[model samples]
Target chain A: MRITLIGSGNVATHLGAAFKNAGHQIVQVYSPNLQNAALLAYHIKAEAIDDLQQINPNTEAFIISVKDDVIEGIAQQLAAHDKLILHTSGSTDISVLLKYNVKAGVFYPLQTFSRTKELNFWNVPLCLEGANENIFKIITELAQTVSNNVYPVNSAQRRVLHLAAVFACNFPNYLYSIAQGLLADNHLEFDMLKPLILETADKVQQQLPAAVQTGPAVRNDETTMNRHLEMLQNQPMLQQIYQLLSQGIIKMDKGTNGKA
Target chain B: MRITLIGSGNVATHLGAAFKNAGHQIVQVYSPNLQNAALLAYHIKAEAIDDLQQINPNTEAFIISVKDDVIEGIAQQLAAHDKLILHTSGSTDISVLLKYNVKAGVFYPLQTFSRTKELNFWNVPLCLEGANENIFKIITELAQTVSNNVYPVNSAQRRVLHLAAVFACNFPNYLYSIAQGLLADNHLEFDMLKPLILETADKVQQQLPAAVQTGPAVRNDETTMNRHLEMLQNQPMLQQIYQLLSQGIIKMDKGTNGKA
Candidate 1:
């Protein structure tokens, strides 16, 4: 399938290159910054366009891989096009492209993209939605080209998934950072917690995380919890995190005991 | 080196069996519960003893792997003997063993232990401390036989490491549970999140987690944050966690920008 890449940010550059590798043709690359567009297009063997006006009218579909806020503006700019169009976003609605005469959909790749690191797109959940069945099928198949998991998720469900992503990915990783900061404050290497972090992730693979919760919080060992809090005296943010999470764990533990 | 396993609970059963697999001699297994002692002893070709009074006093060292509060009581039980002893703990003090009349130290394994899962002992971090230099060296050698990482950390340092473990293992896993609960409320399988969670952990191996933190929190996109809070109202505990962690991330972002 022929695809026109939109925007040259981390996600666009990585996905465009991956799509090209998977035997799809990248017909063109567009970015407000001409140099970024040219660099990415050059790597993917596609034409670089500095202005939205340079987008080919004959291209079957245009993937608006731009940032969330700019998505609707770009779609409006491309309103003259007649082909199916999709914006790769986890949170935005397909309605963002409503002003465009072209059919619209969402082609969100639910994974973190880094410019320096190449990711295996397989198993990355793709949540796609379209205004019509034909556009939906196209976007779904396009997502399936690189991913093993694809879903016809509308904007609302995608919002929940994105929020869950924050819970699973961002919040947990930030907890890891708090751990690192605590270790750093004591002149210790963050590497010391590496094995524990990996194992905590591995455990949920076998059982529900709630079923396997441990530590002072779940055990209601107030003494240890108090000790830990006392140690976090200098780090107020971390102290707040510790208190809130511990309270949550204690609350859940009570629920498990049918006391709630 | 010959090892005598004490307190055949989760940590002891796992560590004792791993030592046997690694070709070390586990000469004795001790537990108040005969069934647990026999079960651990059976796996390691060691003799099971129901009472500390029956403990063989010939081994180089005895590892007391009891629960936190019981460490001192177990040490009191072992105080009647005259041999080198170490309690496997992260938060307990090495001096707790000195109350006994023999060479004593700490051999704290800095990893989460589950009785159901067999662990690679070589990956466990054993932090050892002793009354003096000579006994500390002996404890280090015993730890090196099973694990690659060993530190001569005193009680204070071990306390810090244990606190860090809570952040890395316990809290993040609780957050994973919250994410699982959120998904389950929508009838979504937590399996959908496995890829994203794994990738989040993998990214932190090479990059500072603070640098890689992404989400509405880091972006401080109030609209998305408010929406998430609204969606999470039914889950008051999880809602508190969401608010605390989001606010923490915002503060962290400010710190990085030199605005604090």
Candidate 2:
């Protein structure tokens, strides 16, 4: 399959490299900033372009992997050919592209990507949705070339997945930052919490998170909870976070108990 | 050294097995319920005792690996011999043991333990603090026998570490449960989010979370955030959590930027 990647961010770089490695021809790499496009294009042996009109018309699929808000504008600028047009966004609807092209689809890879890090693309879950049966089969076969885990998900399900991802990945990373800040203030090394963090994530791979919940909140150890709250008195925002998250854990536990 | 493990919970079982493997004798296993005591005792070839009076008089160290509130009562019951006494708690002060015994210390392994899972005790971080230099050396030597990573942490620092653990470990886990619930509500498998969860944790191993923060919150994408809040309108608690945590992330990013 001949593919053109539009965007030069983390997701674009990762997927471009992956598609190139899977024996697909990357016909062009497009970004408003040609320097950014060239850097990624240099690695994948693809032509880099700054203008939307410069995109290769001979390319079979054009994947727009820009920011969520920018997807619509980029899609509108692309010349409508009989070729497939897909956006690699989790939250945006498939309709965003449907307005511009009949062969519109979504090719969302469900994993966090960092440009500096190398990813094993084989394990990344690719959630794909196409505008029609013919379009879905095309994207699904193309996705299967890069990853073993591929699912045919609709726009509604992908939106829910994106919301859940914020809770699972983004929000939890913020909590870890808060923990690191607390340790730094107390003259403690953040290394102490690394093993625990890894283990907590590892546990969920084998068991449900609700079944494995542990802490002062789940145990109802008020003494420890109150002490933690008092210690954070100087930081009102942290104190509020502590109270709210703890209550959330307790409430979830009660809900689980009611079902049991 | 001969040790007696007081309590038959997750910590007690893991520590008891580790001590036995380290070429130390577990002289007795004690619990208020003899049946629970006998189960762990059978694994380590130790006598099981329900009454504190039945604890071996000649034991070198008594490890009280029970609940935080129960540690004091159990410590008070053990006959005060001129021997080391330790509690395996992250939040409780070493002073709790000091009130009952001249030889008091804290042997806190900063890891979440489950009775069904086997732990690699060699990697678990052992946070130790003693009432005096002599007691410190005794517990430190004992801890080194079990784990390679041992730190001499004071009560204040340990308290802060415990508080941080809740943020780094417990709260993130609850957020994972929330993600799981959201997925289940929409007929998606929890497996879809596991890779993202693991990758989020792995990112922190090499970089400070603040440096690597990514999401709508950090990106300041108000459009996506508003969409998420609207989707979560029926669940007020989740709505509150999403708003608070997103605000916290934004504030932290601002602080990092200000420092730069």
Candidate 3:
């Protein structure tokens, strides 16, 4: 299958290479920045184009792997296209592309992409949605070329998944930054906490997160929690996070125990 | 060195096994519960004892690996003996052990311990503190038997490390739980986010967490953040978390960019 990638950000760069590696031809790479477009295109053996007017009309599918906000505007520009049009976004609605293109669908991959890192697309779940059954089948077939885990997730469900990703991926990474800051302030190295962080993640693979949870919060150890709160007196943001998250964990455990 | 373990909980069991594996003789295993003592002792080829009075006076070191609150009581109980006494706790002060015994120290390992899991103690950082310089060296030597990563951290520094662990290890685990709950509510498997979570952690190893952060919060994309908050309207605890963490990330990015 021939594919044209829209955007040259982390997601687009990774997906273009992934599609190319899976025996599909990436016909063109498009980005507002010519350098980014050319770099991605060179890696994927595709033509680099800075303008939507230069996109090949004969490409089998155009993958708009841009930001969520820019997606509709790009779709409007390609409204005259007769081939399949898909945007790789989790939060945007499939209907956004319905009136703009003849064949429209969502080809959202549920994974965090880093431009320099090579991801095994096989394990990343592909959440696909379409305006119609024919488009859905075509998108699923295209998704199956790279991933074994593919689901027909609607717009609403995809939004929920995106929200969950904010908690699981985004917020936790920020927490790590906070932890690093705390350690650095104390003249300690961040690498000291790496093993603990890795093990915390690994525990979730085998046990329920609630069941595996440990610390002052879940244990209801008020002494340690108070001490931690006192330690963070100067940093209001971290103090609030520590308080709110601890309260949430306490509440979660209480709920698990069938209590108010 | 001959060591006697004064608890059969997760930390005690794992540390006892680790110490025994490092060529130290585990003289005895003591626990209030006979079954727990027996279980841990059986693994380490040590005598199982329920009573503190039955503790071997000849043991070179007594490791009190119990709950933080119980460490003081256990230290008081073992004060009559002249052998070195050490308690494994992160938050508890080394001074708590100082008054009760002539030879008191801390042998706190900075890692999450689960009794069912076998951990590589070599990688786990052992935070050591002593009542005096002689005791510090002795505890450090014993710690070096099992782990290469041993630090002479005082009470305040260790307390800070403990607080950091709560953020890096404990809170992230809770966030994973929240994400898992959200997915489970939507009939989506938690496995879908495993790769993303792993990558999020892996990224922190090489890059500063602040530099690698990506999400609506960091991007200052209020639209996606507001959408996520709306999706979590029913979950007040999660809603609070989402708001506070997103605000925190936005603040962090602003701080990084040299803005007020």
lDDT (10s digit) by residue, model 2, range A1-260: 99999999999999999999999999999999999999999999999999987877998998999988888888887746667889999999999888875589999999999998887888899999999999999999999999998998999999999999999999888888888888878788888998899889988888888888999999888999999999999989989999999988877854542110
Q: What is the C-alpha lDDT profile of model 2 across B1-260, one tens digit per residue? A: 99999999999999999999999999999999999999999999999999987877879989999889998987887746667889999999998888875688999999998888887999899999989998899899999999999999999999999999999999999999999999888899888888889999998888888887888999989999999999999999999999999998887844542110
TM-score of each: 0.93, 0.96, 0.95
Q: What is the DockQ of candidate 3?
A: 0.58
DockQ of 1: 0.55
Q: How accurate is candidate 3 locally (lDDT)?
A: 0.86
lDDT for residue A59 in candidate 1, whole number 0-100: 77
Point out the worst 10-residue segment of candidate 3 chain A by lDDT. A251-260
As a whole number from 0 to 100, the lDDT of residue B44 in candidate 2 is 96
- Which candidate, 1 or 2, has the higher TM-score? 2
The sequence of per-residue lDDT tens digits that candidate 3 reaches over residues B1-260 is 99999999989988998998999999999999999999999999999999998988889999998889998888888888988999899999988888775698989999998886677889898999988999999988889999989888889989989999999988898888888888888888788888778878877777777877889998899999888888878877788888988888888853432111
DockQ of all candidate complexes:
0.55, 0.64, 0.58
Better of 1 and 2 by lDDT: 2
Clashes of 2: 0
Which stretch of 10 consecutive residues in model 3 chain B shows the poorest summed lDDT? B251-260
lDDT of 3 at A216: 91
Leading candidate by TM-score = 2
The worst-scoring run of ten residues by lDDT in candidate 2 chain B lies at B251-260
